[model samples]
Target chain A: MHVFYQPDNKKHFLETDEAHHCIKVLRARPGDELVVTDGRGGVSKGTIVSINPKRVEYQVRDFYQVPLPDYRIHMAICPTRKAERNEWMVEKMTELGVHKIQFVISEHTHRETMKRVLNPERLIRVALSAMKQSQQFHLPEFAYFLNLDTYLGQVEAKERYIAYVASEDIPRHLIQQLSPVRPVEILIGPEGDFSTAEIEAAQAADFKPVSLGDTRLRTETAAVVACHSAVLAQIQ
Target chain B: MHVFYQPDNKKHFLETDEAHHCIKVLRARPGDELVVTDGRGGVSKGTIVSINPKRVEYQVRDFYQVPLPDYRIHMAICPTRKAERNEWMVEKMTELGVHKIQFVISEHTHRETMKRVLNPERLIRVALSAMKQSQQFHLPEFAYFLNLDTYLGQVEAKERYIAYVASEDIPRHLIQQLSPVRPVEILIGPEGDFSTAEIEAAQAADFKPVSLGDTRLRTETAAVVACHSAVLAQIQ
Candidate 1:
């Protein structure tokens, strides 16, 4: 069954955008079975009741609740100008089972501000697409914009780590050091990396400095690598 | 210091392309310091002697031999339709430090026949760029357009693993499972994945099945993940 997104399923049906996709693009008709997700862990099985070019209505037949992972992963990443890099990061993070994603403004971030360029909705869409592609039922929360300090103060993970290139230690005990039972928050810097003050602030916030690997990686690649490493460590 | 690729640094002072890049693109002048690599294990510090557009000459000042890693990793993967995916794989693999890369033709490969879309030279150039970007002195050997069976048979790694999504009783072992290893070869299937016969033949040849992670990833993503995971397991 094809899954559709309807954040407000109780109040409104899938809007024209999704309705057009269902009725026109997918050729979904009356009585067609499909699944709809609210992108907040609510999944419902529905049968198409009314199909029209402008609107497609579905009657909810069954609703299933999928529990989110016990250990939450919240990533606050510095955005890269190359949209593909950010898009790839969002897609991979969604597949890796992250709980929340926040785009943070950093000191050396290439794009001083992404208010005009990137569409947070589009990125959420990408995450949703990746979730469907990877057969994942749970959807990660997406935050549009937040500065470094604001994001740092808001993070509520049991354990937090920041990936800094200049750190002398190679983080040998990543898997062994982290608490497997607790939630984790990992911060990935930009291409220019976290500024001196930014690193100091992160350190002040009790964020342990962890090294992803020996080699230097781009901002987006580092985000994916860090997320995967954390997930693997937690699972193991 | 700029890095240049000179496969035959000893015999010829300049390769045509390198000479052109040095003279025209870089506009190197006499006494300028540049690092040149033979793409093998040899690196040389050279100074420009002449700035001829076609045959720019450079004299080697100091030569150093970088030893190869104790474990050699050769990943044979099917090329994806998106050139960016292939390029991203190469970059990430370089950062993770792989010995060699081979593009193979698989049975269920979306791109059945390699039509020679991207220039082989361009792939090498990308590897070189990644090597410099990652601050690595050695460039990986690139093997382009090989049949899967022939390529698999040619590799003489002490241990070989095939990454496949199959329902078997194989215990999930991270690359760390192959502790105290030497030469290792990992084969990643295409988007559609390797056919059953291919997996069977690989098993007959003593290839172990390994899983990278729980979530399904794209071809390029899987290749990079396997490469990084293997490197981490080996180093740790």
Candidate 2:
């Protein structure tokens, strides 16, 4: 079933983008059945009542709720220098299921790179499309780009880990360190990796140091691995 | 340390591309030390002896080998309709460590998509870059695209699995099904998924049906998840 996002349960109208996809793209007609989610766990089966080029209104025939997962996954990553990589990461992370995503800046993030443009709206659209594609009801919340310390200060989770390539002592693998059914957050650094001071601040903030695997993963790959590891850890 | 690929340990010259990257991109001096890998486990530290724009010759100062992982992961996937997605999958799988990657064409693969141009050379370049970037000594071998039945017949592994979305009973999750320290091969279907006949052929070939996770994943995401799961399972 093709699912559409309609964030407001009370509003029968689909948003402009969703409406365009439905009416202009899919050519959905009046009386056609539609599956819609408010993306807050509310899913409704509805029939299209009316359609304008920009407006699609539906009448709900049945409503149900998808129970939220027992554990939450929040991924904080240093946005890659390339926009496509960041977009790809967001898309995959959504498909793998994340509760929140935040872009962080560390000492190693170059000033020119910091000035690089990001289209949050585009990322949100990618996430929404991924959520629907993956049959997920909850859209991941996006946090603004933050400094590493600032982001760590407001951190709230049952467990947190920073993926770092330590020069000295080897850290435990993230898979082994993960406890089942616990809300977890993971931090993935930029191509240059997190500075020593950033790692120390994260440690002070109570984040454990964990390695994803033997290979040195790209920032995006590390994020996906962390997300999937968290999802798999929750299964048992 | 910048790493270069010199597949032939006996040959002191870097490959053309690696030479260009080293000389043109990094502008390394003649005496600068370089880390080079044969990609079959041999890693050597060398000092540049001569530099021509297209040819770089080095003297081996120290030679070492990275021991192979106890287990192997082979991923066979249906190439995504989009070339970028396929390239991305190859890059990530190499970074995450795959012994072999085979592209399969199934019944549902459209003739048009089959004719869709794929640049194998470019993909190999991506894989090489990823192997160097991830600091892995093993480069994944790529098999030519084959028919599903032909591919199924050639499979040899301690364990094999096909990620499928069944309409009936839920299959065992891949993570739970994996046995530690065993060579494993996994197959990921196209966007439309494996047809019933393809799934049956795999089952007949002793490929167990397994689910990656609850959420639906794209062809590329499923491939990465399978690759990572195999890597994680081998840790024990």
Candidate 3:
């Protein structure tokens, strides 16, 4: 069954936006069954009861409340202007099962400011689309924008890591290094990378330096890789 | 310094195509120093000797032959139609240090008749570009198109594996399961995936089943992930 996303579940009726999509775009009609996810672990199975060009209604047949993962993997990264790169990262990371995404501004980040065109809503939509496509139950939280230092200080993960290409002797053990005792917050820098002072500041705040691999990965690719590495470590 | 590819070292001269790029596009002048790689293990430092638009020449200043990695990772993947997707996979897998790339035709592969348009040359160029960008010493071997079962049966690797999403009893240990073999071959299917019979045939040919991650990744993403996982395992 095709699944739709409706974050708000107050009305017990499909909103006009999703309704038009179901009726007009998908040609969904009365008696057709589909699933709707509330983006908060609530999934509802519904059969279309009313269908119109403007509005479509469905009656709930069954519901399942799936619990979110215990470990929250929050990746705070600098956004790349190329929408496709950022979109690719979002899709792949969602499939890898990240708990949240926070786009932040760093000292050497390429794009200082964006039009907020691809806001949290659109990112959440992408996450939902990937989630449904990948048969995943949880949806990651999305945030608009934040400064690196400010966001870093706000996050309260039991274990924090900063993934960077360091010339020094960093911990090579990816799986064993990360502590699975609590949630993880991993900060991935942009192409120019985190400045020296930024790295020092993070280290001062107890963020361990972890290596993804030997290769020099793009900002978006590194983010996805780090997210996957963390997920694999925790699950293992 | 701008780098250009010269696949044939015996010529000891830049080809007309690359000469045009060096003199016209890059505006390189005589006495300018740059690095050139033969896309093998040959790395050379050269100084521009002539700035002629048609036949620019570079005098070799110094040369170094880097040793290849102990372990060889060859990935035989079904090429995707979107050139960018295949190009991205080639670049990322090269950066992650893949040794060989073989484009194969699978049973359910969309592009059944491999067109000459999607040649391995472009993929090779992308890999070389990625190698130069990542400052890697050795360039991967580029293999031509091949049929699935025929190619799988011909290559004899110390260790061989196929990434299949459906197998439940497959080992989750990615790099840990493999022996420290010299050469490894990994087969990645197309977007539609290999048919059931194809999987059985591979199993019969002594290919072990391996899982990349828990998520259902796209073709290119899966290839890169497998490349990284296998390379990291060898490094460990």
Best by lDDT: 2
Output the number of the TM-score-best candidate.
2
Ten-residue segment with the worst summed lDDT in candidate 1 chain A?
A: A109-118
TM-score of 3: 0.86
Model 2 Cα shift for residue A220 (angstroms): 1.1
> TM-score, each model?
0.85, 0.96, 0.86
The CAPRI class of candidate 3 is acceptable
lDDT of 3 by residue, B64-159 (tens): 887887788999888777777888888888877898888888876555345643557787778777887677767887776678878877887858
Summarize candidate 2's per-residue lDDT along A1-236 as a digit string, tens digits: 78999888888879688999999889999999999999899999989999987999899999999998889999998888898998999999999999999888888776457446457889889999999999999999998668887899888895999997754777888888999887898998888888888888998999998988888888889999999999989875
TM-score of chain B of each: 0.85, 0.94, 0.88
Q: Which segments of candidate 1 are over 4 A away from where they belong?
A: A9-33, A46-51, A54-59, A110-113, A168-176, B11-33, B46-60, B110-113, B116-119, B166-176
RMSD per prediction, one decimal?
A: 3.5, 1.7, 3.4
Q: Judged by DockQ, which candidate is best? A: 2
lDDT measured at residue B172 in model 1 versus the true structure, 0 to 100? 72
For candidate 3, lDDT tens digit of each residue in A134-209? 6676788887567777887888896888887653786665555776646999888876778888889888888888
Fnat of candidate 3 is 0.37
